[model samples]
Target: MTPSARRRVPAVHDALADLRWLINPRRRLLPRQPLTSSDHAPNRCARSSFVSETRTPGQASDYEYVCIITFIKEASTTLRRQQQLADMDEEVHGIVIVGGGICGLATALALHRKGIPSLVLEKSENLRAAGGSIGVHVNGWRALDQLGITGELRETADNVTEFHDVWQHENNKSVVVPVRGELRWVKRKDLIETMAKNIPSGAIRFGCHIADIKPANPGSHGAILTTLDGSIIRAKALIGCDGGNSVVAKYLGLSPPKSFPRLIVRGFTRYPHGHPFGPHFLRLRCNGLFVGRSPMTENLVNFFVGVWHPGGSVTKDPIAVRGLVLEKVKEQCSDEIVEMVHDVDTESLIVLTKIWYRPPWQVMFSSFRRGTATIAGDAMHVMGSYIGQGGSAAMEDAIVLARSLSRAAGSGGGGGELCEKKIGAAMAEYVRERRLRVVRLSLESFAMGMIWATKSMLAKLACQAIVAVLGTHSLGHTNYDCGRL
Candidate 1:
């Protein structure tokens, strides 16, 4: 068969199944109910009037016949081509990872590197390349190195050499600390696209929204995931790389991530000619407001502002988000910083979020794995970016998780059916290895957040003690590596 014909065969086969759903009476009526809502009532009435005026009852029957005939002809063609395509793909996969963000793709790539294939299910139709840049520290870089994309990423991002903190409440005190290890801010798009490019084609399936997940049966060896479209997927192992709102994590009986009463606005500013700021990562803290500026490249800078808002709510309007950031930073930041905020590209105002994290205690005790299913990244230990390890930590989770699973699958030999008992043990080990590391990060980040957000001096002192005991210094957490994948 010609290559073009082979490609058309699968497309037609998939289309036939999709058409079956489209032809269902129940499915056809499902969307019409929304049109009857109060907000759409007038439009619905107008549409009804037009239809009634355009067709008599006899003409309506003829119109329906035309539609039905066309649908039948297309479905017949789909079935004939489907047979010629000889598609016999299995409904079951060895490993299925939910969410195709940074963590999900990294986990898939890590498994690919170890010769264990994984299927990534992303709800979005395409890569979610939206959002601001992420800071990758030394530990994160190590994970990337194992995944074999460090060299490519370095070309797009420059390392952050120093941290410059300016305390406005402390009489404008300035402290400069040199970074001991690697730190670079790469655009979310760059990291995601680069990682995606290395992954095998057809490994990541888009537009697959998971509605429910359950064990195949009591004492079952694998998991059954139900997509919103009513299709079922069976997997020998399931990994959840979905973010803070992960449904897979919920299935593991983990508590939802707790929120901080703060609104963070992250935006990028561009200098077409050149930027004046050098390589230093700058931060300004005053009262309950915090601002950070990091250069991603020679002409582009990424900055964020955090305000201790009582309610963690921000308008979705881009203009309003930029204005709010400016309002919070103007009290303490320099005029140069203010100009940068004002000049921020309106389109780049993508991250206006209420910070959320799992408390350290929760991290220490939570059950991140159940049976053959487990979770990683934010789904396992979502933490605030106070320590700037959220992205990196997720990457670490990917490497460790893939490493653990590979060992288990390899023990039963490189190929053939996966052993569920071994897979569960590997998941437990991954959780055990990552628990303490992420707990420490959660503790330090929580303390730093308390110290910055608290108004009472007594409370601030208490948080300070927590920070002291944890020995949480800048660039300290970046030392440990997740080891080779």
Candidate 2:
């Protein structure tokens, strides 16, 4: 035989021997421990020791049967060792979600509620909850209820009863609009921790920075994610809940969210003796700038200042930003509001960032999905905080995405091919359901952002006319029901 044919003989023999062992009714189970753990090294050594003891004394050492048995043992060891190495190279997951923020945690909890498991990859070493506070309107509360976390969060903040709007440009005119539904300013950290606590342990893997994302090989449905550490993660369904500058969004060919040339600084202030502002949401628009304040609790107040800087550039130093915010606050706000801004806790001030939002057209026409991979939260439709809907919209995405995936999985559970096809179809359904809802929000926020930034008298009058026609309470987007998971 040729040299190549001689080498093939052992391979063929090993395959046949493995086939025999697979069919053996009394194959040694005790010696064949799982090869996925650290203990496998010692177990393999123990299995090798068994070969000598199982020998037949009456048979010669050169017997054909003895040679075959010895070769089989050696082949099994080699094959198992190779398998262990391959396992270390790749990790297979059912649903892999990127980001561990509110939206990501909410998605995992929502899936957990539907009996579907998922894995969350967070690039940060800890939760990204340092952004101070977020306002949760009625729609957000509804989504939180579906996640079974509303009650616990309710204890952290009280529902706002009224919205106080003061137009300083119009002779400091005050307009008090009664809040129609639940509105609460919740600490971003509280929301993250509460949702995370409900999810299964070990579901979230931190410090996993994704380096690249691509479609799985042809005939496969899902995505292959490579982390910064070079580990490969194969996900049957990949959900990108990563925020504004999402890597997955770019992979899906989505443009990054555009900045609105507005700088916003949000933070919390403590009143040890109890704050005088009751349950109220305050909005003051003055001198082409905006200042907002709301009571999270009797003693803790949350506030934000919006400044229109043409270049969207602001100082990165915390001290410098604080000084700038205070200087701007004095130019356009009352003594009380200025005092509140000055009293903001030193460490509570979030770094200044430009307001960002996806355009309505982008929200209307983006594919949002490729195979079984899709996006959620800010990655899908990042709208400005002008409408107080960014956080609520992310929660809404979590519920709808989870619900769609659960239904598809339930209907097609028998085969890998069927399940993959169903998952892709499910992603399509999720995008369809969320597209229109997010578009309206994006458009409204975009318009409002322009109105806030424009210095033209004609523009301000037109904005007033639109607001007058729609009425403060007539904005029905907040009354939306995302339904149960």
Candidate 3:
């Protein structure tokens, strides 16, 4: 036998020794039963039956032997087949990730690197770019780095260095506060496109609406997803990178908690030559509400206004919405700002309703991993975008989950009797390790929003005074360590 094969025997022996310890904690170490090629297939191996032992007749000392039968193939072959069977038993033909947005694409690329294939299902027939402009904090860049797609993402994003100019309509003041650290501003479409380029064209299945999802089989790690057209697709894992109104969460019976009391209007406008805003810094104006501008590109400026809107207050008509936004800006902002707001093309405006929730976040599904099915990204924990960790958190989930699965697959277990148990344990570990951090982040974002959206003049003045004393050093630093994921 080859040296490598020779080395494998002791390894297998050691593994079996460890398995015995795991299966029976009270017993002392003992030699494992020898395994052969035919005894390892699922449903073929003898079910674990009771074994009794007695003294041998000829030997001077009493010795015990218990007959425990197990099916065996080559250890390596058995491992591979177990994984395949696990996949089969879970009813997971391949991974089916819902949403073709940033989180969905990132998860796909991460899985591909591990040699796992996946299909992305998007509800929209055409990739409609919404959320006109968005910012990627440093944590987001770290996530893209892990996916090996940061370079491509950077090419389409504007690297923001400073954020100082604060426009205050309440007091007609423009206070400059230094913003430390790095951030990137990009068109939302650009970020999506960058991720899409890394994946094969056929990998994304648009116009597929997932209506329902259920466990593929009892005690299995896969799920059966029923699409709108009544087509059933079995996926080993189901990642819900779908946005705020995720159907996956609903199907899983997770209802979003209510937290915020405001509506957000976002859009893009061409920067008129000689505009006061600089290309390097994000400008924020707080009057009765929050208004901010970030550079989308050299000639385009992305702007947003967040105002108090009792749930379902914003009109559906785009023109009326624009007018209402313009009115708000006019009431508190200077003429220069007013002119810019009016200049924005009505068709380009994007309006999103902002919602919030508290800590100790709960996953809509009781089981994160079942048979062969699991979920990640927004479908797991959807939070406010105040601190801009939404996308970053989702990417972290993908990396952590993929790593866990890869490690489990590398161990001889794969997806067999013991393997499923291992994967399930790992998923539980993930939730335990990740739940508190993401929940804390969500709570922090909610608190920050409250501070920014406070209507009390005394409270706003107190906030400004605190910032003046503390400086802008505390503006946007998140405590999360993305590198660990």
The candidate maximizing lDDT is 1
Which segments of candidate 1 are over 4 A away from where they belong?
Answer: 1-90, 351-353, 414-417, 455-457
lDDT string for model 3 (249-351, tens) is 6655666645666667777778656455665554555645677777756667777777776565566566677788889888877786677778886777876
Q: What is candidate 2's CA lDDT for residue 322?
A: 79
Clashes of 1: 0
Better of 1 and 2 by lDDT: 1
Candidate 2 overall lDDT versus native: 0.82
Positional deviation of residue 26's Cα in model 1 after best superposition, in angstroms = 40
Clashes of each: 0, 0, 14
Tally clashing residue pairs in candidate 2: 0
Model 3 regions lying over 4 Å from their true place:
1-92, 165-180, 272-275, 280-287, 356-372, 412-422, 451-476
Provide the TM-score for each candidate, comma-separated.
0.80, 0.80, 0.70
What is each predicted model's overall lDDT from 0 to 1? 0.83, 0.82, 0.63
How many Å off is the CA of 35 in candidate 3? 64
* Model 1 agreement with the true structure over 28-83: per-residue lDDT tens digits: 55433221112222324343342322332222233344445666798799998887
Q: After superposition, how far is residue 85 of candidate 1 from its true place, in Å?
A: 19
Models, CA RMSD each:
15.4, 11.8, 16.4
